[model samples]
Target: MTGELREAAEPTRSEGATYYGRPVIKEPVWKVPDVPAYLYLGGMAGAAALMAAGAGLTGRPGLARAGRVSSGIGATASVAFLVHDLGRPLRFLNMLRVFKPTSPLSVGSWVLAPFSALAGAGAVSAATGLLPRLGWLSSSAAAVLAPAMTTYTAVLLADTAVPAWHEPYRELPFVFAGSAVASAAGLGVVAAPAAQAGPARRMAVAGSALEVAATRRMQRRAGMVGEVFGQGRAGRLLRTAEALVVAGSVTALLARRSRIAAVASGLCLTGAGLATRFGIFEAGHASARDPRYTVEPQRLRSR
Candidate 1:
């Protein structure tokens, strides 16, 4: 029988054994409204910070302004989502109480604190024409920090026990980085002037290409756990994200001379990024929900 037929004929249990419907791995308690939003916004802000610096250096004032605004807003939203996830805003302070080099969350909190301030300062300076020099300094600093800000979330997710997430540790960082770039580039394509949006359009294409490649690689290497990404709701979302990314990339290439095409491509890429994030999250959730994912992997590992 084919894999799909076998799956249809049998429940997602390991080798005719069952765990009495109990999950072998505990499901993540992280709320959907919070963690996925944090991941998306944090990545968008990080990529925007890099774009802001690049645009400023290249003398594209309009694009720079768009990047600055996006970085600040995205950073703020990311923090809000994190705080909401924690259930108490004040609990965020505990994250700063110490620095643990081994802890991705600890490192992320530190990175976010300064990144948020710098991005905010840059945005304010652009908006109010105040402290231009300081704004330049902040934007520059943010650019340096932005890469870590975007990629550390991958480390955070990979550090987890969930098979779907932890198994693809090598590729998740690149996947997230690509998604971040695509999202920020999409924002620029939508908000920046046509003349200034050239780099953004190029970035959107490049980033989307990287995201698609990395995701496919991850799925291929994910072994039995990879099935989660191809089944049920997660599969639908992943398929949708892939379609949108392809469509957006093609539109971006063709958008060089058309503002309407640029806008449409921007919307498509942004939606693709969102769908990708949610799909990954749901895949992890589904993997944890199924005992086979947890048991089968370990059973193989022990041999």
Candidate 2:
């Protein structure tokens, strides 16, 4: 990301605070679809790698193969979105020059770079039935990196000045992890046969539960700043996401019995994941633009 920010309006004084309607911090200049899509896809890919690894261990070759393919595609698309947002592919490469543990972006770049390559290599080999050793190695490596890939974005976002993201840092990762799990399970359910889909259906339920719990906790803990997630565009998207999660989890029970139900459940889960990412993205930006979110939190802590 450019990290460039939009200028806020001039401050107007009121009640000993820069009150009324104005931003206290600069809003992100990140464009639409690019950043949000990147987050969603990256998380999904990360979680998919884990599922792929699990399936491999349990002798479910079909699910394992499908997960590898799904992970590869998601990772590839994620890189594309990141590059598009950066406005140049070379910028991403530059980030790999050094590993900065303190900087989520830097570490994320390194993680994504290797993870994508390995996942892609694994997917190709698994699909084409070539380079079996290379496929096993790369896929195994990717799974090791998947947890980081899935959650570093939450850290990156919370590290920012945006109150909606920063104040809820403690809970954001759980929400994101759950979102990723659900999305990965969605893919598994859609791609694997009914007999091989039991694990995926269980993941859908587990992920949905975790996501809902974390989201609720985050919002409640955030106090006033949390309002951004419950109002305007963010609210609409989040509500939709939660609804989809409910529908998908419920539908997944019937998925093993019917292909149509599996497709429907998968769609709902994926939609929920997409909507959750975008909704969180929107909430962060909205919080950044509002002075109250930045000011009120500090004010409360001082008391």
Candidate 3:
């Protein structure tokens, strides 16, 4: 999450009005560790839930067990990170007291609550063989809720005034969704038996391709505002992520014959997914530090 802030140079006379190099939007108070961890884990949990559902329907018991366990672990960890970010656990509980359609956090709180419970139930069933029927129902419910849980955070961030986040709102969900798929597939590849790992490897390849494409498109459409993604620590991390994703996807295609290759591919995709989350977080900070990103876009629109 390291990022070096490089302020924009003074605007030329031709460049519309300036605001004394001051930020128009307040920088996010969210810390690096908590929010990014929440993002990554939530994505992983959501995708894992989907994988669990798929494995159940297809009669792949080994993959289904792997998915259930991963979903539960990821969902639990994501909540811990979120509560840590809030500084007080009660703040998250309070968010669930009311439902506000206009508020992503409010909606997300509702989403996470049921999903977490269901994920936990699924895991318990897998572990203790208790309430098998209940576990099936819970896993089904979680699979239905997973997509919203995964993408709502992107909408939450995009709802903000942060220049980097808000500008590419349309693509952010896809970016998050693809990352989640890759992460879950990575876990599946590593944990499931080789015979049942075929679908996971294919998913890893597809998700990696989608993530890379969507991310590049987001940066391209963001214009100068996206410069944060191309410089400093953010840039380095993103480049590394892209490389890993590409390599992992290729290796996954060849993993059917080699256990070692499957492990290697899984590690690569997992690392890439985590790196993408951190890179995006660092890029947001970089965008906020530069006043030009805040003011220039509005100046153009008004003209």
Candidate 2: clashing pairs of residues: none
Badly placed stretches (over 4 Å) of model 2 are 1-15
Error of 3 at 195 (Å): 0.6
RMSD in angstroms, candidate 1? 5.4
- Winner of 1 and 2 under lDDT: 2
Q: What TM-score number comes out for model 3?
A: 0.93
For each candidate, what is the lDDT? 0.89, 0.91, 0.87
Best by lDDT: 2
* lDDT (10s digit) by residue, model 1, range 1-303: 998997777755544444656787789999996898899899999999999888988999989999998998899889999999999988998999999999998999999989988888888887788999998788889889999988989999999999999999999999999999999998898898888988888899899999999999999999989999899989998899889888888888777688888888988988998898999999999999987787777878899
lDDT (Cα, 0-100) at 99 in candidate 3 = 99
Error of 1 at 95 (Å): 0.7
lDDT by residue for model 2 (96-173), tens: 989988898888898899999999999998899999889988999999999999998889898989899999999999
Cα RMSD (angstroms) for every candidate in the order listed = 5.4, 6.2, 5.9
What is candidate 3's lDDT per residue for 1-303, written digit by digit as tens? 223332345454534344665666778899878999899999889999999899999999889989998998899899999999999999999999999998998999999988998998998898788998998898889999999977888888888888888888888888988888998998898898889988898889889988999999999888778888888988998998899888888888777788888888889988998899998888888888777888887877789
Go through the candidates in order and give the clash count of each: 0, 0, 0
**Estimated TM-score for each candidate:** 0.93, 0.94, 0.93
Superposed model 1: Cα runs more than 4 Å off:
1-21
TM-score of 2: 0.94
Q: After superposition, how far is residue 79 of candidate 3 from its true place, in Å?
A: 0.3
